[model samples]
Target: MSDSLDSLLATADVADRRDEVVTGVREHAGRIARELALLQGGDYGSRDFDTDSGTWTVKYEGGALQYLRYDGGREEVYVVSAHSPPDPEALAEALRDYAAFVEAYNAYVESLEGVLDDVDTDFPAVASTESVAAERDRVLDRIRAVSGEMAGQLHRAEGTDYGTFSARVDGTRWELKRERDQVSYLRVGGEGGIYLLSQYGNPPATDVRELVGSVPAFVEAFNERVADLDAGLSRVEL
Candidate 1:
């Protein structure tokens, strides 16, 4: 027979454990090596102690732990995951594609630097060097936001039964989902919504076939726009 509720409650330690403490990176790799390496090791976010990294945090709840790392003056999120964080070597290999992205990103910025020489701001829309630099920064920042998100995507693939995957790029969140009849793209924001992009006959292997294959191109295409937003400076250009 099942135990009565009163009997089950006898040993439940329901009170909050105020003495619980967390410090240091729980998963050693998968995020940026240099970035994590730079973090100050000591008690940081927890109320009870100094953590290894001032900006890192680990929270335990339900049946799992959530780890997070913040960067960019702590204004940007660097890592967020609830599953296995990949080992250092694997992460490095996965980031290989992005290494080219960095090169492309820098080349784009360098070309924009030329715009500074044309100090012809008398035109109505011609921005000042400082203004252009800020705009340049915005473009690069978008690359960073997307890259961090892609890193998370590369590591976690444990769940697929739901026929859905979601990601955030430069503050804009998007979800890719496939139902039996159609594949959909959903953008999450004030006017939250979804759009049926394509109807499918069979199960759309949307994960690797779409996400992995297309993300690099997506980054490339977005990086390409920096020129039109800034004209072709260089893959970074495309």
Candidate 2:
């Protein structure tokens, strides 16, 4: 071949080689983007496209990137396009970064698996807390206060005629009765804390109690109130 023709052929070969390099890197970038897209999960109108060059998927979107560009505080990952004449070394570094990022994210997800598994499978777990116990105690207090007050008031009001009382409040059904020298009372239904509130004058000063659940605080309060009332009753001339 003539010198000029040979030179033209060589130049064409060089252009083709340059095109290959650019095309190869872009295709690689597209593959990386595709992997990222899969990792992203939820559909942001993501779709993989294939052409003669290769397959590639959008990251966010060209428009989204444009909007993010002007936002001073916004930070995002960007990739060099093969069309932009990507440097081979830069592309390799980017691939390494993507691999590391994927690995790191996968590790984070694996770490969370134990928590998720517990959440999904572990049932009847010990969810009770001190706060819960306190709340239960409060409910018990309500039962005690209401039953005691009603029992006391009825006993005083009956003035020897106080025989029996039955009432319901906030889903708690209660009954109070007097037997000879004893006052008996009961309340049921409030946060699973009530069984029976029957009482009989066992000791000379106060009534006996048969109740449910362990709420020492409320029991103390109720016992104090009833004991005081009984003491006052002992003093009255009537």
lDDT of all predictions: 0.37, 0.45
Error of 2 at 127 (Å): 23
User: What is the TM-score of each predicted model, taking all chains together?
Assistant: 0.17, 0.23
Off by over 4 Å in 2: 1-32, 45-58, 61-83, 87-115, 121-238
Tell me the tens digit of each residue's lDDT in model 2 across 49-113. 33332232344443121110011122222344323443344434344444344444356446655
Q: How many backbone clashes does every candidate have?
A: 10, 1
Cα RMSDs of all predictions?
A: 28.1, 18.0
Compared with the true structure, model 1 gives a TM-score of 0.17
Overall local distance difference test of candidate 1:
0.37
